[model samples]
Target: MTGLAVVGVADDTDGPVVHLVTADERARHCPDCGARARRSKDRRVTRPRDLSVGSRRPRLVWAKRRWRCDELTCRRRSFTESVPPVPPRKRLTTRLRAAAGAAVADQGRTVVQAARDYALSWPVVAGAFTSHARAVLPAQPEPVQALGIDEIRRGRPRWIPDEATGIWQTAVDRWHVGFVDLSGKQGLLGQVGGRTAQAVIAWLADRDQAWRDAVQYVAIDMCTIFKSAIRRVLPQATLVVDHFHLVQLANQTLTEVRRRVTVTHRGRRGRKGNREWELRNRLTRSAARMRGEHVDALLDELSNLPRVIGAPITVAWNAKEDLLDLLATARTGNRSAICCTGSTADAPTPTFPNCSA
Candidate 1:
């Protein structure tokens, strides 16, 4: 089918074997120098793996030629023949490698899974995907307008014992810093080893000066290290703090409030059948997400509970709702009246103790 002459075909222990050779033998040009070589140095045999044909996989054994380059000026050496379906220094055919790469990259199969499907070793499949990625994907991109910085934990924390004191020091094994380009379609820029200022600055420093100058905005969390690094390298760029962390902070504050209210009112940790414990999750949920009927039902349920139990929980719930409202209104670019002004015209503040600012 590939236009190569089929010298022989036989059944082997490994399935069907197809012996192939080049149909037309012609003089080949020297790879280093363009000069043609007419002399044959030797002939070699290569067995490259091909794709499976239906349920049976055919092994391709190719008879290859070697040519002697007679050019005096050129670094003269004997070069081997390169034919269709098999490139130089490769044991697998082009189609076989491409199939493995597509399984891993395009079809989202793991390396082990792709290896099993292709009937190849795991390392072979993984190397094919790596080569395909390098060939097809762009190495460097134009400067990103908006970059987002985040970190991911590598593994669970470990405790190292002190030799003398016998006290264990807690340590996190590995952390990676991920940079994302928010300006264009290419989602992830790359990742660095550690989540420190030095690691980020070193990655940025590798880019050209023009690329660095083109960066306009950076979005990061409340980490001072990330902010400090960005301020030094891209001073002109605007730093926008990520709002997701703020919402997380608000949720944590609500939990703390719930715990404190539980301790003060009941003189113990919350347990089953407590109204505050029952409605804990509902309390942190935003007012905008709650239906009118649901909110009314919850408020009625709270009003009927003991005043000491219901009052503190209501305050925390209202504060959480207010924070969500503030964030939502800010997102839409619309102004809403602040609820915490110390005046009769303003609404009463929800008594969350730790969330003043």
Candidate 2:
């Protein structure tokens, strides 16, 4: 824009049409001091394709000039001249750099495509975008109460070679997300939680002390590592096991009991074993397929099973109900409780019993 002026357009023997621009000045500046100076040595014209201005193709036509600094305190003389809109060391224009950044941020396009579109070299486009994103994106804020921790996988390709035959297999991996509360709202905290404990701990360590102190309660699944991380990070906070995890555990226990009962019933009627097994399978599958009110009704019917094999089923059902009761109790009284032995403990630091059902 400064030195070059577009003159005319001509079609090349190759496909693309090219625009010609001419450089006018021999002015130069000191690279170290950024002080204006006259050209001490003149170089050949370096014409590089620049960003498009409107519909017209733009070209950068300029000479690289070497200038000598007059200041004695300066480290050395003989520095390259600076371009106005383009970065000091790079050949691409400021507008092209911006377009490349937008491509990465907004369109989720690869750096290579962005570079090609802007007529810029890969390094120039990449460095500018990276630098700009680092400057503009805000730092992670601290969590106040109810932080959630999770993990995710980064950069790993979807496919990997199997160890046995060296055949490519699709891999399923995860990365961790740690949510922090900046506003002290319990509900607003920790939406991102993943499988890794170390990632959760590191995220907690990044938060400020004031935010840690403001936390009164933390709701998490029964992940031992997550619980341990919470204990280390926020020792004073109340820990409440999430209801969803408890329900899942109860459902699993119920399903197991159903499987055992179905197996025993089929054994008793030994004649049509295959047909009986298939029927039982259909029933089990139907129970699994049941949703919402139907699931609740099935659970209720399971709860009414006679005291023979139904003891475990009843226990699992009651456990689920008790879990819901605890959640309601906490919500009504605004007090947290630790679940232990199919019951809620009132103690601040309650010991949880090893009860699967």
Off by over 4 Å in 2: 1-27, 33-63, 66-79, 89-92, 99-143, 155-174, 180-202, 218-221, 240-244, 256-311, 321-357
Worst 10 residues of 1 by lDDT: 348-357
* Cα lDDT listed for each candidate: 0.78, 0.57
lDDT of 1: 0.78
C-alpha lDDT (0 to 100) for residue 305 of candidate 2:
53
- Clash pairs of candidate 1? none
lDDT of 2 by residue, 167-198 (tens): 99756344445453422443233333345566
Per-candidate TM-scores read: 0.68, 0.55
Q: Write the per-residue lDDT of candidate 1 for residues 31-149, one digit (tens) a residue.
A: 78877888889899998888999989998888878889998888968888776567779998899999998889899999999999998998899899988887778778667777788
lDDT, candidate 1, residue 313? 68
- RMSD in angstroms, candidate 1? 8.0
